[model samples]
Target: MASVKPWSLVLVVFCIMSLSYFVNGAGSNEGLGASFIFGDSLVDAGNNNYLQTLSRANIPPNGIDFKASGGQPTGRYTNGRTIGDIVGEELGVPSYAVPYLAPNSTGKAILYGVNYASGGGGIMNATGRIFVNRLGLDIQIDYFNNTRKQFDKLLGPSKAKDYISKRSIFSITIGANDFLNNYLLPVLSVGARISESPDAFIDDMINHLRNQLTRLYQLDARKFVIGNVGPIGCIPYQKTLNQLNENECVDLANKLAMQYNRRLKELLSELNGKLQGAIVVHANVYDLVMELITNYTKYGFTTASKACCGNGGQFAGIIPCGPTSSLCKDREKHVFWDPYHPSEAANVIIARQLLSGSTKYISPVNLKQLRNL
Candidate 1:
């Protein structure tokens, strides 16, 4: 071939790279092959429906705005999709992870992934005991362990291992119930065992969560995104329960969550350094939710201090949303769906941030980066 000019050679290389980028962008539908979800109600999807638990959302008014289910609850504890649902959709996953307890969550169905989260679940077994029946982190892990075996059988050991280890994103949203239902319960607080001290309780939480995360790593999950506890003190339920000013969140609850989050970030950093071939990204939800509450109008929400659907209390937070609960005329204008969960609109906002934001929003890396890696 004849010698090419330097500028011409550079232009040719640029065109080739541009073409490659376009091709990859077009084929991006392949997405992350699977999403294995763990944790509590924030990401439960519908696993709690199969259990005999009081912490259920498979009722009316709960899914009045979920167009996907003909405005019916899919057991998601919100007006529409949960954070897990939004994240899966944004990442271009073919479908939401099937609830581990669902009849369809077996054999070939598991090739996509499974959700082991439960409505009342927490990092500790005793965390949600008041609900009578709930899956603790240990039980959820056991379910995941079983699913791993099924994956091995379906795809054969080598293929299954490769798929899980390389093509999946494991997302967890836990710890809120550990504080809401256990540590800060007005009565029958299980956190009382630790003498109601933030230090002891948080230490217990960190220790259990570390083991829980390691178990997933051992099961060949290489990509992980774990959300930190949000501003628990600012939830409508917390505000109503504490009888704080309309514009004020529960101070002690907020303090506890901040303390735990500090340690959680440290723990994630340590795990990322020590775990082989693992990418753990921490989703910083406190600041995100706090922003929505303190400056609701900026996010197009009319009120972040009250819920869209609930009963009694200044914030309509005395009771969880039910058939008899009063609902706001505009669900999109409220950050909270009921007393404890974010509305679908709010979840969409948070999910987008977690997936695409920089280190300030999601430490180490965001979900998009994690998926590409």
Candidate 2:
């Protein structure tokens, strides 16, 4: 795998979202039952509510687009649910509640893990540097460790080991906002460029990420499903501000992401090799998302270029698309649910691909190899 053409992220020539191409979904949760997630908004389910940051979504218009239409207490970016929410239900669990930040009512509720992903978090502890209070990745893990300590006290070592060993599924989706908000934006004030070259920057970034995850593994986290970055350049938000000016993806950003994913595959393979019975998986969001952009006509998208809400401008991607802002007549016919996020309809399709296997991207072993472990 040399350099990935922005168009062909999946194995097929043009990586469109057919869902029909991969036939072996519904198998990822084969033995695993519950999920514990920690990252950023991509997998966040309301953890930011407890934190003090302006990057909050627990307001009006946020949940308006969801299937529950605000009935759901979920703080996901989507109108209704995220892939995490769907997968939780699929695993016969309730909403994957935010751990530590979200309170557990009973002693036995620790059976399934909770989500600790803050909206602006990253692999480094660099999230929310602009705001007063935010949990960086290291602190988030610290919170997770502390909570696990509590669970250990309550459940006792034997049952805690049982829960950790048997049905615990760990999902981590992060890194996009690390570049966007912390590094790219002019206002965050911390403009520390890891390096000038995209390749070097990504290597440094994900390498830093691997060390943190390795610490988690040593602490008893067994199963891991790491999400690959989506086509950040194609996002209406990025396309509006950065892409159109250059008339292409912010190649620096896109290239870094591609390199990150490419390197991530090799890193994950080696991790699986070193850690027996532990799994490392990738969700090729780059291809799943391109379907919403280039092949909009085929995917029933009426407007792939603009978000459904607000002016469809550079800022629209920042908030939810609803009454206070602009609203598309139909959502199923569109791709992005928000300027920064995907639709409920889109997530279901992406979830299908991830469950199939990590391959079509990862080289030697597919997800089946990890699951068999």
Candidate number achieving the greatest TM-score relative to the actual structure: 1
Model 1 segments more than 4 A misplaced: 1-29, 190-196
Q: Which residue segments of model 2 deviate by more than 4 Å?
A: 1-31, 65-73, 187-191, 194-200, 243-248, 312-315, 318-323, 361-373
- Best lDDT goes to which candidate? 1
Question: What TM-score should be assigned to candidate 1?
Answer: 0.91
Total clashing pairs in model 2: 4
* Residue 72 local lDDT, model 1: 89
Q: How accurate is candidate 1 locally (lDDT)?
A: 0.86
Q: Native-vs-model 2 lDDT?
A: 0.65
Clashes of each: 0, 4
Question: How far out, in Å, is residue 27 in model 1?
Answer: 10
lDDT agreement with native, every candidate: 0.86, 0.65
**Model 2 error, position 347 (Å):** 1.0
Error of 2 at 154 (Å): 3.7
Clashing pairs in 1: none
Q: Each prediction's Cα RMSD?
A: 8.0, 13.8
